[model samples]
Target: MSAADTTTPTKVPLPRQAPPPTAPITPPGRRTSGGATVPWALLAPCLLILALVLGYPLVRLVTLSFQEFGQSQLWGFKPAESVGFDNFAEVLGDGEFWAVVVRTVVFAAACVLFTMVVGMLVALLLQRVSGWVKTLINIALVASWGMPIIVATTVFKWLFDSDYGIFNALLSKLPGVDMIGHNWFASGPEGLAVITLLVVWGAVPFVVITLSAGLTQVPKELEEAARLDGAGAWGVFRYVTLPILKPIVVMLTTLSVIWDMGVFPQVFVMRNGHPEAEFQLLTTYSYDKAFVVNDYAQGSAIALLTVVLLLGVIGVYMRQMLKIGEVE
Candidate 1:
């Protein structure tokens, strides 16, 4: 009893400590509620404006998709009644529709990729240039970025026109480009190539400006440190510069996707809405159905499909942004 009691009597009380401070948690892509709450008064104006400007048109378009608004409805006094999912069935059931959808996705992707690459290169070039050359570049960039879409398309047409195009003129002088006219719009591929070049040319300026700005935000010391560590120029950029520029690059690339989706004027004017052109992108198809073919309800359905496709693309981008925001 004496030995057992002696061992049991040595119970020292443990010291209590305050619980470790809980870390502040924030949902991804959302601001933490740690600061003063935003007043509804400050947000209401924006919300109302958005509702009228964007919300109403979107709802109207969606509603239009379900109605059979044909030629008779468009010009006639007869009101079009809701036709349920008939418009959707017609658009989705068609083989040509799916073909156009696939083509649209590929075309948009190509344009975005090329535009990003060219823009990045131009941006890098701008960083290395200075003095009057840099000033001229900046001026040229602003002009290109600000140019009218129609005007740009027109200029591109002149540059690529088979008979009188400067491109053909240059190519004919080369070793074996005997195809005199080399019709840019002779086939779908040729037409798309011209449009792609036009889009890239116009889009590069914005990309250059944006990437150049982003490059400025990168810490110079980090770059210097990397270089001091014997990293080559490409290595420094790959490891250090690119990591900092990633967010900007992703954003600009997504914007390019959106801009490339509805490439109407370029394709329309180039093809002159030729039915024989073996390719059909969603934008042109929708316009053809709605206006050219005079099938408004079916056209609206296709238009809605385009919107849905865009939303899918945007959702992917938002997820990436949210992940980045959460990590910080």
Candidate 2:
């Protein structure tokens, strides 16, 4: 056809192909139901294990706390009788229980304070030391952390023994000191002080390792910047390093409190399984009530109360963690 006449067959545009399917858009701050369930699904096995391991004992403890379950019922000679709030009332009313509670609190606070302070100091030292020295320190920490509680307690007990303890011998060698036959456990406060040292000794390793790891995550550049701004060692740590390490500190403190408060083997074994009234912590107090005095229900009630108190601490920890998460 002639060029002009070739007005040609007009080309027709093919319709645009539809875009390929895509995932549905979820709104901000929300997830798809299936996506949301993934975390729970991943956690189900752990939750199930915890429920199986802890559920029955917790339920039994609560039930026993509300009943009159003494040696008679314990051996099946008589049925456990429901006593409503009697067990709780008796425990709450006893002056000794309050004393034990106060002692436990003070002991835990002391342990936590010493643990954090020593741990932080060691962690800072680790940062400044040579590689080999840091490795050596870490190895020592791990070794101590791995030591069994019973073994450690025995070692500490011998160290502070009334007659032949090396600790006493060393003290006696000092000028004008006569500690050759000193009995560390003769008084309640003195004995508790020794146990506190042991607890702090054992607990320091974990805190050190954890804090050291946390310190590694701290941005060195931020610390350097702080230094450039005329910050001293303490200032850099307080303003820069500490805020970064707050969560770890909180977690370690909470765990230390829980562990120190629940200490039993130390006091029990130190006193040959019969911690005197002066040496009694909540754990030993409950043990004395349940086994020594054969007051099972009252012991359960005391233990339950201790659990509630610990739960409060855990609640505070969770709240702090959530706040930190939000801030981040």
Candidate 3:
């Protein structure tokens, strides 16, 4: 080739540029779905089950609260006759219902406060203990919780029984005691006290476990630093430990309130709605209205009211939880 031809670049056909590789088509079965869509599809069954089991009943309950039973329809369906707000008016106006509600709120509040304080104290003690003692304490508390509620109720009832109660027997041994066999569940306030004691006994272990877990999350360094700064044990706990534990404490308190408010078996077995329903909390009241008196309408109304109260309590709790860091 001439120098000029050699210097010139060879006219080799440029390699054809290949089209950008396309994504492999997912087979109808093998294709992965969108992030949001797949979750919703998988959740469909659970949502359906929740609606059927929880949603429908709650809706039915609210509906029943607004209706009264009437003659069965020709199709054999007994549609409730709407009574507008009569049920609400009746429930609100009933002195007994309001009394029970007030008692429930007070009892639940007492239970939550006492249980949280006692449980935190117990947890602090447990943290100070060592090895086998810690294990033993845990086992004992867990065992108490594992006992069946009915069994616990029966045992407590016997402990507080009018004739054969150990509590009265112990009282008899005290100096100058006149009444040895006081009936714990004879009056409204007294019965509520007994119920509150039983509920606190059953619930404290859970608080202990939860609070102890929260305590573990508190940094040892922070505690040591607080101590070096001349902060006393109480001061450290008040400022450092408690602030960290606020969320867990709030959660436990909320749960305890919810649990104690709905308590039934302890009061039921202790008194059986005795002394003219003196010991009837909302749960027992609803049960008695539904089954004993066959007043399903009243029962449904009670249930719906109880639900509203609980929801309100939960809303307050959530608000408190949200406001935890605001003060600090």
Candidate 4:
């Protein structure tokens, strides 16, 4: 065989190497399916638990709220007599109920605002201090937070009690002879004030801890640069620290509102929402309806209403937080 005849034929392109056996082109949907199934599988148990615990109860509560309960209906198993919104109408028509709602809103607002302010102040003070002072403050705040709610309520009740209260004792020594042992719980506004003070005192510690952690995250370099640029301490805080702290502040405020709206222990212990239900907030009202009045249906409705109000507030806050240029 001559060289030319024996040589393998000159190499051909071979149809462009068949495009290098390109990887099996997965459909977009199929790719999504592959990555998504694992997460869905893992989340199934959580979803199931949530449905069983939260979703079912919520549905049941709504259903029960529409039903009528009587003394004979001890188990509440009898088919719910269609009340046709009578329960809601009756609740809305009641002047006392509306007053309680308004009072709750005002109380919650006051508590949240005062708690945030006091928390921020305490946090800033701690930031500037060192050594034993900071440690002591932190310990006191944590101790208050760690105390059982029932214990705290009992202590506050005793402290504020009119008969043998330390408060009344001190006031009596202040030369107020006319009403030395005046019944604090008998007065509506006074009872409400006591509740507000207790709520504020209990919640401030949480706000302080959250804000202090947020304050520490403020960049030292930014603060220093601001100072170098002739910014005062207040200016540095306003321009640098506050903008970063906005989210935390908003979050803390929202949480405070939620906590105060559902306030129960203080009012329950202080006077059991007494003096014509003077210190009754939404949670106390619900408790009275459910347990005291033996009207779980009405109580569930009130509870649901509270939940809705909270959700509405949260939604508004989120909208404000998410809006561009709103934080600054």
Give the number of the best model, judged by lDDT: 2
TM per candidate: 0.84, 0.89, 0.83, 0.81
Clashes of each: 0, 0, 0, 0
lDDT of 2 by residue, 61-164 (tens): 99999999988898899999999999999999999999999999998998889989999999999999999999999999999999999999999989999977
lDDT of 1 by residue, 1-328 (tens): 5777767556788999999999887778887653445677688899999999999988988988999898788887789899999999989999999888887888888899999988888888888887789889999999998998888988888888878888888878889776577887767777777788888888899999889999999899999999999999999889998988888987997788988997887777666665443557888898888888888888889999999888887998898888878877
Those runs of model 3 whose alpha carbons end farther than 4 Å from true positions after fitting are 1-33, 37-46, 70-79, 273-275, 325-328
lDDT of predicted model 3: 0.84
- In terms of TM-score, which candidate is strongest? 2
- For model 2, the superposed segments whose C-alpha errors exceed 4 Å read 1-42
TM-score of 1: 0.84
The residue-level lDDT of candidate 1 at 202 comes to 87
lDDT, candidate 3, 1-328, per-residue tens = 7788768576989899999999988778664756668889999999999999999899988887788843242234866678988988988899999988887788888998899999999999988999899999999999999999889988888888888899889888889884567987667777677778888889989999998999999999999999999999999999999989989988888888889889888877776544356677899888887767766777889999999989998999989977876776
Question: Tell me, what's the RMSD of every candidate?
Answer: 10.7, 5.3, 7.2, 7.6
